[model samples]
Each structure stands twice: as C-alpha cells, then as structure tokens.
Target: MQSKSGTQKIIMHIDMDAFFASVEKALNPVLQNKAVIVIGAQTRSVVACPSYEARALGVHTAMPVYQAKGIAPNATFIHGNFGKYRTFSEAFFEILYNYSELIEPRSLDEAYIDVSHLVTSMKAAHALAKEIQNTIQKQLHLSVSIGIASNKVCAKVASDLRKPGGITIVHPGQEKCFLSELPVEYLPGIGKRTKEILNQLNIFHIEQIANMPEKLLIEAFGRTGSAIRAFASGEDFRNVEKPEESKSVSRSKTLEEDTLNTHLIHAEVFRLLEECSLQLRQEKRNCDTVAVTVRFSDFYTISKQKKLNFTSNIEKELWPTTTTLLQKAMHIHKPIRMLGVTLENLYKTSQISLFDYPFSKVKNIQQAIDKIRKYFGFEAIQTGRTFQKV
Candidate 1:
C-alpha cells in the first residue's frame, strides 16, 4: 500500500556494518562476538576492515596493523580475500536490485538508492528500509545501517547517524534541521584543507557554515565556497547513478619497497595498465584519457595524463601515450613507492577507421587474445613484457 503525497526526491544510503570483518564472521560461526581484523596483502599493510568487536577496542580500518595490534591485542587477524567478498557483494547488491534498479554503488558495501517513485511518504520509506535491513540480517547474517532523506548527501550523513542495524530518516524540508548540529566536516567534499579554512573562521558547525555570507565565502574559497555553502544548506542535486555509469576505471599498487629501477617501475605500470584495459574491454568501453602516477618514497605523488584524438581500449593503441605519461611521472629525485595507471573519459566502443592499419592489426590480435582468455582464463595468455625481470 503506497501513500501518494508531495513530489520530492527520496534517496536511501545503505551501508553494511564492517563489511569485510562481517563477512569473515559469516563464514565462520566460531569467530562471532570476537574482535576480528582483516589485513591486506602485504604483512606490513594497514587494516583493511575491523569488526564491531574490534572497533569497540579502538581498532579502525586503515589504521596500521601494528598500531591496531596495540589497540586490540587479542583480536584475530584474517587476511582479506577479495574473491570471497566479491561473491557476498554480488548477493548483497542482488537484494538491493530486488527493490530498485536505480542504484549507485559507492563501494563494496555501500550504495545509494532512489525510492521516490515506489514510496510516497516518509513512513513508507522507513518501513521499506527496515524490511531490506531485516532481510539482509536474516538471510545473510549481516547488519546494515540506512539513512532516508530527500537527497544523497543528507541520506549519507543520516545513515552514519546510527550504527550497525539502525535507520535515520530526514523528512523533506528538515534537511537543515537534521544537519545543523553536525560538525562541518560531516558534509561530503569538506576535506582537511577546507576544514582548516573553515576552522580559521571559527566556522565549525553546519549552522555556522550556512550563516556565512555567500559573497565572503566565495571571495575566501572561490568556486568551491559556493558548493560548501549549498551543502551546508543541505542542497544536493546529484542523482543515483547506476554502478557502471562511471568516468574512469583505475588500478594502483603500493610496492613493497621504494625503487628507481626503470625496468621495475615500467613493468609495474604496464601490469596495472593491462588490468585497467582489461576492465575497459570487458565493459566494451574506450577512453580518451590515459594517465600515469608515481608516488615517491616521501609520499609526494604526481600524475600526468594524455588526451588522445580518439578513444580506444586496445593496449597497443594506448601504449605510446601511457609510456609518455609514465616517463613524465617517473622523472623525480625520490625513489618510487607507488604507481598507478588510469583510463578516463570512457564511453562504449565505436567503429574505428579501417585505414588505421596498425590499430586494426593490434585490435584483431587483442580480440583474438580476449576470445582465448574468455574460453580459458586470463592467465592462459600473457604479454612477454609482463615477465621482464626487475
């Protein structure tokens, strides 16, 4: 039974409670009610996720594993498994898909959903959220927190209002009231530098941010200031974009040690690019922007991107531009600790001119490679360059 009411946006932000750690518990009943922390690939890597039990002991995600150990000394540390999590994520999103297809996944465990058409009243929305939350809890043995609001920002903020299996709703026109008391940092897009600027002005709350003179804020912060003011007023016009509706596909790795070896650095960059390009091909997408990044030992990172005249996912087609960007990124005095390859400005693949002989040959080669990989596995075909010694 739907109650027809005022026409306004209704968005829900659903976040799984301690997604990775929760999945660990779901897999092993013996681990329940105990502090658990998931570690990333490298032994020295940071905490990928911490269970509520671990969080209660002051362990947090992204805290160094060493520091987290100090905080939760008796916590069980499990190595994170992306494949297992991906399976759970698929099931999790499938449940959400049962409710609506207008879903935007923010990460592996969180997403935004627009239910404006299905439920016309706040009460109905809350009921639906509870149903969804309960379904996940009963079926998957996982806790979820949800926020119901008129827009994504408020909903995201509200979703955080309560923890593990809680719901907070901000009725239409109550966005300001709901956000007034929260710290200015709670607003999306308000990062460290912005917080510093706002703090300098003694602007620490949403109310203070909302009350700041528009012109003065604009003069002080430029174009971003206006956005800050609007966000403070709880104004968000962003829509819930479908998960595949994206501008880029990127992958990066932090190396185990800092090195300046050309062979080692270039090899890592190409491997990352190979992964990014494979994703592009799988999506049947092509890109105009090819970029490379290098993070030095000191953590000072730099990137350079090349905009091509045409779009492509063909590795050979992207090779030259990517090499140029990599060269531009690696010309630093500091040893490189991290590298990334990103493809941007993506769209569905389109026909290429037949006269482009090299692209045609390479494209044919890649298509053949993709077919073989599809039937066998990605490991069945390998680029000779990927085997180059460091």
Candidate 2:
C-alpha cells in the first residue's frame, strides 16, 4: 500500500531473532533446540537475550541471571562474545544490500530499508521480504522478523508484533485501525511513567490516544502530546536516515572482580575519563557535560552528571567533575562492578573560543601528551592517579 507521500516510500523493519542467544546457538550445534541464554549470570551482567525456547519459560532480556534461573533452571547460560556477533552482523547487512541499498542500521541486530524504488506493489515487497528472510535462515542459520508498512513507525511496530521468525505487513490505510486496539504502552516512545499518566486520563488504547482532544493532549503532555498523536494517526514523516557522526564520547570498564575498594574504583574512573577525553580530542570536539556511572555488585546502577562552565576535551579539567559525579553516584557505598565516564553536549573544535582557556599552556601540553600516547601507546604517558593500584 502507498503512504500519504504517494508512493514515495515503503519502509521495512528487520529484527533478528534472539540475536545474541541465536548467534551462540549457530556457532555451537549442541546448543540448538535448547533454552539458551547469552551473558554470564555470575557477575553484574543481565540476561542479554534468551532463545525462543527460554522465552516460552518466561526468561527475558534485562532479567537478572539470578532471577532468570527461577524460571528456566536448566537453561544454558553463556558469556556472549561480541566480536563474533559483529562478524555475523556485517554479513547480515551485506545480504540486506542485495535487496535494497537504502538501509538504515538500527543496531547490530536490526535495520530499516526503504524499498520503494525496488518494488511498486505490496505483493512484490512481500515476495522480496520472504526471499531475504529465507536467505538469512539458510545462509547464516539465523532467522529474522520483518515488518512492512507505509511509514517507519508502523513498520517498526509491525516488526515487533511477532518474535523469532514471523513477518507482518500493514497496508497504508490500515495503520490507524491496526494500532487502535494496541495499548498506549505499545506506542514507540511511551514508557511505564507515560502509561501511568495516560491511564490517569482514562486512556489505555492507541485509538483513545488518537482521539484525544489536541488542546487537551497538549495541555497534559506539553509538546510531546502533539507528536505522539501524529504517530498514533500513522503520520510519521521521518525518512530512513543514515547514521551520522557520534554526538558523545564515552568509555566504560567492567571490573574483573566486583570490589568495594574506593581506591581501585577511583583509579578506574580516572582511566575511563582519560580514555574518553582522548577520544573527544581525537574527534576534535569539546564537551560541556561530564557524567559518571557506577553499576553496583547487586546490579543497581546510578549515574550523576553536571554541566561545566566551559567546554573542554582535556582530562585535567574534566577530572573534578567526574570525581564529584562519582562521589554522588557512590554515596550509598555500594560495592562497584563497573565504572564509566561520558562526555556530551559537544561543540565543534572550530567553534571554541581561542581564549576559552585562560592558560594556553595547559592546552598545548594536552595536545603534546595526546600525540605521545597516539604514537608511543597509552603506557608511554602516565597520569599520577593511573600509576596507583589499590
């Protein structure tokens, strides 16, 4: 079916079936037909993915391994290898390009393709979807679910309707009807908190959301109300866009052993902040917001951040903020399993003021240090904090 854009677009969403768990099963034949879960349950890691068999037993993503055991006691839990998954994803995209080159990768396990130019009729699109789905299942031994619709929102929702290996198609005129019976929570951006708010308004179904008075919705949800209303009406005008440059730089480390040692945690934080700072400089970007995240041994995670008065890519200037954020995040004195730092609110190097730094000597030193690390390796340089081990 044609969109309101009048045959200008046909969006298709492809989602891999139990991506991580399936990858493990594909590599190890003995894992086939078993209720397999990828990601170690012993540490702070959560269940990355569960096979269809495991899902039937109520195991799900983000469920802690400790808890998932209660549901699938016999399921095989594995520590997933991402390098292999990336190799599989690279091959997966190569196959997708054979169908349509206008592909937008949503993640390593999913992508969207604009097939308007390749197929005029819905019948042709369905035929091609089945063709690509079968090709992946046969070639890589992986199954994918596909959703075809007039717009991306509808296509994305359709794709998730069926799991493992199923395909669903929504005609242009049927978008509103198809969504009408779905819960408000099914809308793309609506979360648990948003659902609670919508419920207070006596709204539960997508149809109710579509029919809400525009002025009332705007009053209740501010600008967000208008956007979701358009989405409920299946009027998403977004094109399948290409990936752009990263807006933030970040680095994280999961400790080999979960520890309560403050000194060790502090050192790792400095290392992450240093690594993240180097990335910002490499990209020739400056950031005004610095954030620190701490994942506790029990898997409770907390993040704290603050805006700096001036943008910077230098670790020396960034450290105080990272330290303060780490302090705030660790106020509970919880045993830490991971430490992370992120630089955001980025600005281009060209846009920075020449006199942004009161002392130009610091900037000159930082540039030289980055060059040494780039040429002689990170070990060639040592920040005093990094030299210590608790």
Candidate 3:
C-alpha cells in the first residue's frame, strides 16, 4: 500500500522502558535489578518513572511517593536530573536520524521511525532494529524496545506488548489479526471513562469496534469513535515527523484549590522558572523573551510578556525577569486557578565563556554553584527565592 505521496512505508516505534530509572541504573550498575523510583523532593511529588523491579511491586508512573513507599518500601529513590535525561535522549535520536529521515519523537523517552525507503524486507527491518538497540546499549548503555509495522498504530501497540529490549514486527498483511484480539483500552485515546462506556456495550476487544456499525459508533462516541474504529483496523495515515523546534518552553500546574495569595503565586512562578531555564539549557538554546499566562477562578485568562536584551539559561537570572512579567499580568481580580511561565525567541549558542560575568569574582562564584548543584543534586544548592517559596 502507498501513502498519500504514493510512497510505500514501514514504520517503527522505539520506546525506552522506565527511562529515568533505567538511566540511573545504567550510570550506577549497583542499582541494577533493584526496585527504583525517580521522584522530586516533595512527598507529594509524582513518580516520574519506576524500574521493572518496582513495577512488580505495584509502583507506577505518576503515583504519589507516599503511595509508592507503601507499595515498594525497599525501593531506592532518585530525584531525576532532567539535564542528563535530555542529553541521552538527544543523542539517541541522532543515531536514529542516521538511519531514517522521518522520525517522530513522541516524548523524551519514545519515538517513531519511518524507514520504508531505507529497507526492503521485514527481516532487514529486524536486523536494523537489533543494530539500533545494540548501538544504544554500547554508546548510551540503555535498552530500547522496538516494534516494526506498516503504520503508526500497530507499531505503537507492538512496542508496548513486551518490555525493555524486546522487538515485535507486524507484517503489512497481518495488521488486522495482530491488533484484533487486544483489549479496546490498548487503542490510544480510549481512557478509563471511555473504556467503561465501551465495556457497557460489550465492545471490550478492538475487533469489536473494528466491526461496529459506523452509525452506532458515531452516535456513541461522536467523531472520535469513528476515528478509533479506523485505528483499530490499522488505518492510521499519519506520517512520522521529526520533533519540531519548540515555539515556547512553558510550565504550569492545576492548583489544589483556587487562591488569591500573591506570595504563593510568586513561589509558583519561581518553580516554573527553574524548570524552563533547565529546559532551555538542555535544548542548547537561549531565550530573548519571557511570557506569563494566568487563568482565574472565573475562567478569565490574560497573558503578558517582556522582550529581553539577551537570553541566559541561569534560573537565578530568568526567575526575576519572569516574575516581573507575571506581576504585570496579575490584577488580583479573582482567585487564580493556574499559573504559567514561558520562554521564547530561542536561538542556538556555541560559545562558552567563563568571563561572561562581571569581574572574576562573580564568575568564580557561579562556577562553584554549578559544581555543587551537579554533584550534590540540584536541590542541594538553592537560591534565596527557592527558600522563600518554601
């Protein structure tokens, strides 16, 4: 079968298992085969990822640590270093791009590759997967699971059936049989609520939806239901694409409850600044602008931004700038429901200088802070702003 451009295609989904925990294990071999969970400093913090050993103990991504502790009391926990994860992720994608031009990064841990023109057979595709996995293991010391198929849906599902370092291939002619027996929940976009509705209709298997009458499915799920049916039948026509240059880097959170406290709002802005600054550094880009978005209890929204003289990825510098933008946008009209901080006007920088700071003293102090944060963990070194937030 040909894509809209009349090009035959083979698609592959590559996924890293419990990426954060796995990377920690790779860096410290002693952590291997031990239950591990990556989290932030807050007990209310969510689990970023859990190793397979932790998963067996009922630990899962996004579970609060207190719950995770109950599930895996003996598990080791690590506050993840996003800088390290992003570095490895970027290098991993570079290797993939060497083999195919059409690559889609779904997240920091998984991506899809369209290698139709590069390879001609299922056997060849399997060989390429092995080579990719081997290269990653050798170069990055991480394991990746790969699934090869004719389309995105099948490849995505196949990638998840088996955990780390496994490969599954779905031949073009066998897509239907390969996907039919799986549960409806296996299809993306069908969340817990939708699955309940489908289960009520006795349509638990993907094949049930594939064969459902279009009119009834549409009546039950609207246009989305029709799309899901097509997906179940292996009809995804989307093409794999490279990760787009980010238009903006942002951070936001749904508050536990609405509040009008300006101090709390300021604290939230600083936290966001820390995350955005790190993201900019990881992407090797600097921002010349800062923007703030706010949502109010009455659902009113407003935004404001400031153009900067130059971009820097130091949180201490960026936080103050971002705080000014947020203050301008906040009028205290209603309790705030959410807060957002963003960086834009991104440009790559290649030069590194130890003399950028005014006088040698400032530069030396900055270097000391960087070293402390790197070796002792980011939380080990914090600015006054972070303490005030606490």
Candidate 4:
C-alpha cells in the first residue's frame, strides 16, 4: 500500500509475550511450554502474569491465585523475581538504544521504535526485527511480538494481533483498511463500559465509527469523540517518547473478608508497606514521605501522610511511620476492606545518613542485615518477626 504522498512513517511496537511468566521460564528451563503462573509467595497475593498455556485455561494477570488455581489446577506457580526481570529489561533497552534514540519503552517488556530514519526499506525493518527477536530469545530466552505500521496506534494494535513469536507489518495506506476490519473494542483504551455504550449506538466495528457522522459523534462522546473518530480512521499523531524515571512507588491490597480485627489489619498494613519499600529499592529510589489509606466496609476511605526528616526505604524505619498513620485512620470497630501505602518525595542519591540518630547502632545493624539479604537472598536470614509465622 502506497501513501498519498508516497512516504511512510515507519513505526514498530515490540512487546515481550507474558513477560513475568516468561522470565520465570527463562530462569528455569525445565518449565518451558508448561502452564505457569507468577504470584507472590504470600497466599493472599494476586497473580501478576500467566503464560499463554495457563491463559488458555482462563487464567489471567491480576486474578487471585485461588481463583486461578481453580481454573488451571495443574499449572505450576512461582513467586516473581523482580530483580532478575529488571536486569533483563535494562539489557533489552540497552540493545534498543543502539537502534534508534526515538524509542519509547512502555514497560519492562513493551516498547515502540520509530525506525523510519534508520531503516528506509520495509524489508530491512522485517530483517532487523527478526534479528532482535532472535537476540532476545538467545540472550534472554524470551519471545516477543513485533508489529510494524505507519503510526504508533496501529503498530501497537498490530503487535498484539499476533501472539508469542509473531510479527505483523501494516504498510502505509493499509492502516485504515486493517484497522476498520477490527472491532472497536480492539482499539486501545476502549474498555468494557465504553464498548457497551458504543454497542448501544450500533457502533460495533472500527469501520462504522470511522465513517460515523462527526457532529453526531461529538454530541454523543463530548471531547473524546474527535479523538476516537480519528483513531478509528488511523489518524493518530502521537509520537514515541522516552519515559521519565518513576517519582513514586506504592502497594495496596483488598482483603477477602472485611475485618475489624486489629491484628489482621496491622498485618496487612505491614505487608503493604514492606512490599512498597521493596519496590522503591528495586528502582533505586528512597522516600521521605509515607502515606496510608484505609477503606471501610461501607466504602468510605480516608488517607493520611507523614513526611520524614530523611529519605528511607528500610522497612524497619518506614513501617512504624505507616502503621502510626494507619492507626489514626482506622477504627477497630469498623470492618476495613482495603489498605494502601504510598512512598513519595523520592530522593535520587544516598545522601541521607541513618547514623545521625542516637539509635544509630541499631539502624546500622538493620542495614547490615538488609544488605546480607539483598545478596544472599531473603531466605538466607529471617527475623524473629518472620520466624513466628513459620
């Protein structure tokens, strides 16, 4: 398909297929082709990702492990290793940087590459994608799906059209035809509710919306109507962008049962705070502000925050501050259904010292313990607090 002006905007979207689960498989080669699910070791944790084999049985990310197990009973579940995943992601991006500076990494496993400047020929783009895919599979043992198109939106959609170890190339002038054939829901950002609303208006496929009357569409959808109409027609003008460093890290969980028990509430709060701090450390970030949120059984929610004098990601230091906020926001008589902890006001350098306090010796010992765990693995040592659970 030739463009009207005979020039194409070459863009490619590459996404690792089932990234977390695939990483687990890569580390443990014996798990290849086996149904796998990545979850937290904690029984209450949610499934983060499911391999395609497990997905076939209706298992999916964000599902509770209990629910996922009910569906894919024979599937093997492994706790996620975020450290290893991040290392692999960084290496992948380092390789991407060699190809083009106009690359946008959407996540640890998804990125958009504007290769128009680098590879003028479609054949070269296809060949380059093959080489990149092979490199990842060989170096990382991870398969990826790549889509090439004239714009970012179509390229992203085309990438997902083909699953695990596949590529779809939509040459210029064919995007409209290619996109029109897809369901409106297939376009990004159209969620279940939006689909229902569009269906009510007899707008089932993208083709229908592309040709829909602009005035009537605007009256129905407000400000979003023009964007949606243009999107359906493959008129996306969004550019690939290099993402900024994360400014905050947080963790939250919903309890299966609304509980008024103080012990259980505190346990959940500590769990969230520990998880959030671990995430911040993984990103090499430290927080000076700690915030907590509590939602009651009736859905009323309250949040409180405290700013510390120094930045910290140490659980021992952060938990007390978070728990104090939790204590104030929660009423023991009310059954709380959800809890969240956020660490903000991130510090880029290890500029703050924990040794300034009068209790510096104790803090030093804790830091030593954390460093040991960081290198030797968490299972190498356990505190009396964790030992009680065992």
Q: Summarize candidate 2's per-residue lDDT along 1-390 as a digit string, tens digits.
A: 444557756789999999989988887889999999887524777899899999999999889988888889999998876546766786799899888778899999999999998888678889989999999999889999999988899899999898768889888688899899999988898988989999998999999999988888898889988989988887788888877778888888888788888888888899888888877777788899998999999999999989888888888888888899999999887788888899998988776643355778888887898777654456567788986654
TM-score against truth, every candidate: 0.70, 0.68, 0.80, 0.79
Point out where model 3 deviates above 4 Å.
3-7, 252-278, 281-288, 293-304, 308-320, 326-339, 345-390
Model 1 Cα RMSD, 1 decimal: 6.0
Off by over 4 Å in 4: 1-8, 37-48, 57-73, 77-101, 256-268, 355-390
Clashing pairs in 4: none
Best by TM-score: 3
Candidate 1, after superposition: displacement of residue 171 in Å? 1.5
Native-to-model Cα distance after best TM-score fit, residue 59 in candidate 3, in Å: 2.4
**Residue 6 Cα positional deviation in candidate 3, in Å, after optimal superposition:** 4.8
Clash number for each model = 0, 0, 0, 0
Q: For residues 114-201, could you state the per-residue lDDT of candidate 4 as single tens digits?
A: 8777677778889989988998888878999999987888998999998988989887778889999799898887888889989999
lDDT of 3: 0.82
Instruction: For model 1, give the 10-residue run with minimal summed lDDT.
Output: 350-359
Error (Å) of candidate 2 at residue 49 is 1.2
Candidate 3 structure quality by residue, lDDT tens digits, 114-201:
9888787889999999999999999888999999998999999999998878999998888889989999999878899999999999
**Clashes in candidate 2: how many?**
0
For each candidate in the order shown, give its overall lDDT on alpha carbons: 0.85, 0.85, 0.82, 0.81
